[model samples]
Target chain A: MKTRDLGSAAALAILGLLAAGLAGCAPGFDHLEIKIDTLPPLAVSVDPTNVELPVGIAVGITATPFDTSGDKMDSDVVLNLVPKNQKVLAVETSLDDRSFVLFGVGPGTTSISVQVDHESRTDIPATVKLQPME
Target chain B: MIRKLLLLLPAAGLLVLTGCPVTDASTGELSNGRFAYLCVDSSDPTCDGIVGKAVIPDLLAVGGAFDLEYAGDSGAGLVQVQPASDVMISSTAGTFAFRIPGIAAMLAKNNGGVVADFVHLRGVDVDHLDVLGESLAESIKTLEMTTGVAAALAVSPRDRLDARLGGALAYTWASSDPSIVAVNMASARNSVILAGIAAGTATVEVSLRSGLKMAVLVTVKQGVPMTTSSSSGAGGSSSSGSGSGSGSGTTTTGAGGAGGGK
Candidate 1:
């Protein structure tokens, strides 16, 4: 009976160690926020603002993510973009999904929702205007 | 006449043969060293009118094709690029195209000897051009230039990250109307000389062999006295870019006074 009690205690300790090892593998991010790195000319009033694109022209958008701790995360973060109005704007995602090329399809207003590691930011405004003939 | 001529020819031959070394004309042999030359074929549209020479000054973009012409006395010679991955010579017959982005030296050789002309190959993986006097979107609406003056336009080849690529020969400068503005390659890699010929508007385009290109609209006005302060101001404006972006078109500062928004 004493041996059985000792064996049970040893098994419990082993399980606790296994649980602690798995806990150490968790991701460090408390939360993720969208960060815009580049913007087109005359498209935004300032940095970190809405986009205004010229029709038939494209604007490159580079979106990196920062965690709640304000530390910029690298490749591990998953990024996804969904445009509310595909007729006005179309999003072309890069191989890593962190970078995007937003093309103005027509003259209209739309919005893009960016999701990073399951945390999403919605309603990023985009306006497309007609380009004057040269 | 024939008999006399024949007798004279034998006497002349005997006198020459007395000290001259004998050589077999029938046998395919070269007394001197072998030689070869390379030229660009008309297959490359960018170099279509350009006659192939020992060295090509133009830069070729990856996936751009250029025909290679080999002329040599060496029977069945071989043509290959050093660092073979930079270009693909699908046929030794006489054509080649770039496969990757890098510099490679093309060599043509065989049992006789290597060709005298060695082609210096340059390739780039370019997506867009950062024209020094263009907008943030990399487009120039209108550029005004003074007649009888030169505008230094700097253009850079950028990859996806907007990082600049090297090798000046990889870019080609062309003027739509040379009468208005003539395109001249500057000594510096990124800068090009747009010399105003007359009062008119022309398009100056820079391109890679791969067909990736950018253009600037240039309007030449009547010449002024060209004051030192104006010249300095133009140079300063080109250096200080009017557009947005870190170090974008910075090389084009000399173009500022030569061209401004009109």
Candidate 2:
């Protein structure tokens, strides 16, 4: 009789655990809801694609990136200023890492290409004209 | 019966263990996402990075290894997370955690989504990595050029005409009205001699590879120019073993060219 009582109690525990396990196995149970964003940017862009600066003056630059959906992606982009005339134009990046300072060293034009990761890049044509800072 | 119960006990424990599936707990969700980054500055010397913002920074120093943390509905604060180099589990306070390495490469390998907005660096202040509008497009200034003799086409700073390709001292010149006055680029290194074939107004232009250009109106009178002068500057035609004494008059009208509007 004692064995019978012990067996029934053990069975109850097992049933209870199995019921809980079944519930846990159900969909939407305690599962790690992970959605790793894995989309490559199709286009790279910059804010104010065109910029101008006077001699001895400076401007900030912003590079933007977009994915295949044409959505502005949240990613790191590289900015490169290819000034046709470096004597007339120069660029420096800020610590903020988001903006760059364009100095009108002299007078001329440049091409700013922002690379969106290793996959894509876009060019923004920038022109700098000298206005003698009197 | 006892044996049967004993047999079920192990399975019971296993079920109980499995029951703790990481679903919506009474508190919040446990899953989250991550990313990595690298950056450079526009400063001098080593413009790679700055702990913050600065005018003068170590040149060519590119700082990197930034990341992101996006949590699901469970707003409960992160509890315990393995703060290691190889991996990161979301259910912890791993946001901006530095000890983590290879996250950037891992994400890159995954071809994960990238964010251009902001980042949190361990040794550096959290800041926006990419920004715009520091300097704006004020007014476009056109490249300046002067009118030339109708029958003669040549480059001359003395004529108040400048044409530099990529800001180099060389360029290719063309005439809008070639019949009135034609330009031959092959004849000269920096100068485009205008051969006045007839009397008419023509547009003489100088340009560079960056799409930068300058144009001016040239009203060719009856006669070809007696002498053609070369510009005297670093990239000047005159300075390049060439001579410039005079053009009819000072340059007039610095008009628009290819890259002016841009």
Runs in model 2 deviating more than 4 A are: A1-47, A76-85, A118-120, A132-134, B1-262
CAPRI-style quality class for the chain A–B interface of candidate 2: incorrect
lDDT of each: 0.52, 0.34
Highest lDDT against the true fold, candidate: 1
Q: Quote the lDDT for A70 in model 1.
A: 68
Candidate 1 DockQ, CA atoms? 0.01
Worst 10 residues of 2 chain B by lDDT: B159-168
Q: List, residue by residue over B112-178, the lDDT tens digit for candidate 1.
A: 3322222344555667876775222343546788755777776656665665443223567888866
User: Per-residue lDDT for B70 in model 1?
Assistant: 37
TM-score versus the correct structure, for each prediction: 0.29, 0.22
- What lDDT score is found at residue B128 in candidate 2? 17
TM-score of 1: 0.29
Q: What TM-score quantifies how close candidate 2 is to the native fold? A: 0.22
